[model samples]
Target: MATTEGDQKLDKSTPEGAWKKLLSAQEYHILREKGTEPAGSGQYNKFYEQGTYVCAGCGTPLYESETKFNSGCGWPAYYDNLPGAVERHEDRAYGMIRTEITCANCGGHLGHVFKGEGFPTPTNERHCVNSVSVKFKPKE
Candidate 1:
């Protein structure tokens, strides 16, 4: 088996059962089980601080503070992500087509990205991420 770059960041020695024990029920559900937290109920929904946002599962830097914006969509909104920080896939769940974003390093479900919603961003795109899927590291 080849040890990919992603495999180096996240500890793979831990078994699935150990991961269940390592994370909380909610974190497990959102990060591992591909579940979503309720909108407007996230810690980062209204949080704006000077720092970088990293993946909760693997601590890979995903977004910078300057990329964040207030979309009033009840979630942490970013105009962009750090280069190659996340991967996008076609999500066709729940009778809807959406672009699903996940941590490139750990493959944890971050949230979805949407475009053409009329947001004043350089790319006119929105990376709507789940708070539980990320951790904020304040600049020091």
Candidate 2:
């Protein structure tokens, strides 16, 4: 799939043209513009099966099932990311202090990371991810 950062203008010819045809304006907005869906409404929040989560926008493998944990934060949470799979940036958007996480391969927004979660995992980090940003692939 053709991936681009920020808002992707529909050219009305390529396969993305079909995607533009299929997805709603909001889906296009969040997937392409790195917009966040409302916290409690994400589909991945309750995904509990054993699987791998990949970037919805680019199909990049992001997090493994073993790393996922219940953070009770109303979103899919992970203790760590796949090595070199995601990139971080300083985000000052919406007048808040936070770091933005994006897929290293496609620059699609994944979520944010924060410290001091105190999870038993080696990394005491919490990767609070958006459900819309990922697709779950069940294990064999």
Candidate 3:
């Protein structure tokens, strides 16, 4: 993605320590440490209010409310993201070859993106993101 502090990897080379200092324990775990919130427990799992979702780490606009959908996956699901708002990487964690999504601005771990589940979205993609990894700004 375009060069941005958030686009860089969260590691020792980056200002991870500074980010940790600014984030809560939960936020740090989910965003910086690439952890997942328990399904159905995230604040945004059932939230459908009109808003734009931004990266929790660096406040980068990521997804719009129009793209949000009910995927019955117990997490905030989106059909798409703002262009260049996120970057995808091959995640081999837990022996699964899934695509991991990270904020293009702050490089915080948002969650995974899946496809071919017959979703009725234009892209047929499900961006299952952790609520803690993002913040909502209701359209005014």
Candidate 3's residue-wise lDDT over 1-140, tens digit each?
A: 22235455433345777776778999999999999999999999999999899988777789999999999999999999999889999999998899999998678999999999999999999999999999999999
lDDT of 1 by residue, 7-112 (tens): 5326335355655765688888998888999999999999999999998776789999999999998889999999988899999999999999998866788999
Top TM-score hit = 3
- Output the worst ten-in-a-row residue range by lDDT, candidate 2: 5-14
Best by lDDT: 3
- Model 2 pairs in collision: none
Error of 3 at 103 (Å): 0.3
lDDT digits (tens) for residues 1-140 of candidate 2: 33445445322232555555645666656756778888779888877889899877666789998899888888888988889888889988889988888877766677788888678777998888888888899999
For lDDT, candidate 2 versus 3, the one ahead is 3
What TM-score, over all chains together, does every model reach? 0.89, 0.80, 0.90
lDDT score of model 2?
0.77
